[model samples]
Target: MVKWIVKFRNERSHLWAKVVMAIHSGGRSFTTIPIKNSISGVWKNIVQLGKGSSLKLSDVQNRLEVKMGCGDKIFFWLDKWVGDYSLKDRFPDLFAVQTDKFCLVQQRYSLTNGEIVWSWGGESPATHTDMAETWAECVKLLEGVKIEKKSDMWLWKQEDKQEVFKVSDLRSELDGMDLIPET
Candidate 1:
């Protein structure tokens, strides 16, 4: 049997919760034990393990590695594939960790299928307008858009319209608005 500890901290409350799971290599499952308090630093088996059998340390570590790896994969997929446009545009406070390079705000239309696109700020109005129309058409056709990052360009779904617009263009629009700051 092996022991593995997982800890989570609440940023707002500053509270911590720790879970200790014991795994048995032979059984391929965790031991049912309640790790109520950390002060004692003892492993008390809360569940019966068939009359005297307990988990070994090696088993616990293996289980922990497997679980942690699975968690990391899921997190990677969510960050790479999902786009929360409203949150990206309106509530930076809510998602403090999302970066502009990784995500985009949901647009009015969804991109069903298209190639990725990129645009920098301060492009000509004709170019910007064309890009915007293309993007809007993409949204209309695909129903969703995903902004993907590459070494030199951002990729996104779009239609073959004469016009095209990018996130940088949208930022320019926002800047032009000159919205008042909240007091």
Candidate 2:
């Protein structure tokens, strides 16, 4: 139920398409003929439009606006694992001994362009002996550099320069916190 705004780089287009198709198709549970047919129909439409005609990450906010109508629930898929780093830091006494293997982490983030960005880190979580260095490296890569902030909103720059991403309606109490967990 955790939502994500996925953004895929050009090289990862195939994965992006698969995920979108999965979303529209109800992932692994769509089996009714009508649902299947509807999904197939949508896929055909997308395919006919071609990649160039397809939506970009920049279109996601507007697209969500349309699709969600007045609903407050946002939808997204997580292709990676994420951990509660804040919890780990805040209650080290409670979480310190929990192995990385037990910590769940989110794998994907949605960019404004409608693409999914994969986490850039090692596949496995950092071991107990290497947790500090691993966590530092992951934070360095995922933390956005603050660019501007107002009373109600803040603009931050992602590590990827080619894609300019911003976060509005700041809500840290929500899960994910605009960061990808390093596994």
Best by TM-score: 2
Question: Tens digits of per-residue lDDT for model 2 on 95-132?
Answer: 33443312212322324474334332335455545665
TM-score to true structure, per model: 0.16, 0.23
lDDT of 1 by residue, 108-137 (tens): 123246543332212233245655564454
- Index of the highest-lDDT prediction: 2
> Could you tell me how far off, in angstroms, the CA of residue 132 lies in candidate 1 after the best superposition?
1.9
**Superposition error at 88 for model 2 (Å):** 22
**Model 2: residue 42 alpha-carbon error in angstroms:** 1.8
